[model samples]
Target: MSGGIGRRALITGAVAGAGTLLSGCDRLGRDERFQRLLRTGEGGNYAVLRLLQDRTALAQEFRPDQRSPVFRMNGVRMPNGDDYARHLATGFADWRIPVEGLVAHPQAYSMAQLRAMPSRTQITRHDCVEGWSAIGKWTDVPLRLLLDRAGVSPQARFVVFHCADPQSNGTMYYESIDRIDAAHPQTILAWALNDELLPPGNGAPLRLRVERQLGYKQAKYVQRIELVSSLAGINGGKGGYWEDVAGYEWYAGL
Candidate 1:
């Protein structure tokens, strides 16, 4: 599991108070398109910046009222697949995220069971690689809890997310994160956004909110989770779809 800190650092610390995050989401986030058009730091030079990273450093969180008025979707609104369609139609009554590979007690967890577990609600900023951002309130079960229950094996070095959305080439999109971020308090498999059941356009059923990284790492329409020892041979094996296909870095921290 590789990770780094994004040196395109606009924030040095948490925002001061209520409505501050909302102001950025509505006012600054949108306007940044122009700012980003002018300058970009050294391209993908993440390794050097990572030396100063605090793996435990929390991404800046916000007040509920500070959530973006319009939380933009990162990738396709809905994934393509008959199984996903069936699950969606039934409100995911039977859909389950199978925790497989390198776990002592592997099992698929249903949405009902996940919701009944200990949950955390957070309002955090999602920084996109494209230079825009949004503050959203998300409720999710901590990934650490699920991993603990499943008893992840010591050999499992990376947590891979197998998603249902496919790209133009017809391959499904997938992403991976290491155990350090996996156990981070804010790393959650969120089922709700903005105090409501996720809308189809917003990764209904489930999505990952790995707040420390870029939006691309926050995979949507996730179908299964595989804990693997290495990323080689998985898809393009660079750690994520964009990382493999688009040359994005595997560990995109901010």
Candidate 2:
């Protein structure tokens, strides 16, 4: 079997066992063996995933005929906060995405300005960390163009995305990408999908489409972009929400 298949199978087995254990009892504190087994199993799977991502080339896109009949939304379906609700009421007319951080020039851009920039469209596959995939066409402005316009400084090595979705207590969704992926031709801030205006369920108004990585890395409902030299000072200091909270790999470059 291929490396991906092998790794996926192992992860599946571990998850199954973990689920069984958790179902049997709620006291993870009492089950030291179960806790150790779960952690080790998850770690092994993550390590293998990282290895596969590091060794593999960019994922392949597809022809129009190969696209999915139903490209379901994978992340936040609707943001419930008052701020998001206000924007939605106005049809996002007042929403401005703040672009700041270590750049020579920091600015706020409206959705109109983003839509006005030169754009690229691609029918790429969206691979989820949960082991599912779908193909959908994306239309957006190349991320490099926006970065260039803001004059990203040489010191800026990573771009952090701040979003509107809240995942847990006092926690927000965020992700970061290195300069390499930022400059990729396929990297975009998508505003449309499958030839339709982006839906609220699929990060309407704006979203990041870092085609080279998994779906989680494609942060949705993006409200801000921060350029930084390092990811050390961010929440949990692991570069992303899932990475920090759930031990997902930070550099999911697949």
**Cα lDDT listed for each candidate:** 0.85, 0.86
The alpha-carbon root-mean-square deviation between model 2 and the true structure, to one decimal in Å, is 9.1
Best by TM-score: 1
Please, what are the lDDT tens digits per residue for candidate 1 over residues 1-254?
A: 13354433324434343457777666764576744542244233355454566767788888778889999886788777787789889999998899989999999999999899999999999899999999999999999999999999999999999988888889888999989889889999999999898887878889998988899999988889999999997988888999888767787874
Encode model 2's per-residue lDDT on 1-254: one tens digit a residue: 35656877899999999898887777764487876676676667656765665432455778988999998886579887898888888888988988899888899999988998899998999989888989999999989898988999999999999998888555779999888788888889999998887898889889999887788899999999999998999999989999888778776743
Model 1: how far is 17 from its true place, Å?
A: 51
Off by over 4 Å in 2: 1-58
TM-score (all chains, Cα) for each model: 0.80, 0.78
Evaluated at residue 176, the lDDT of candidate 1 is 97
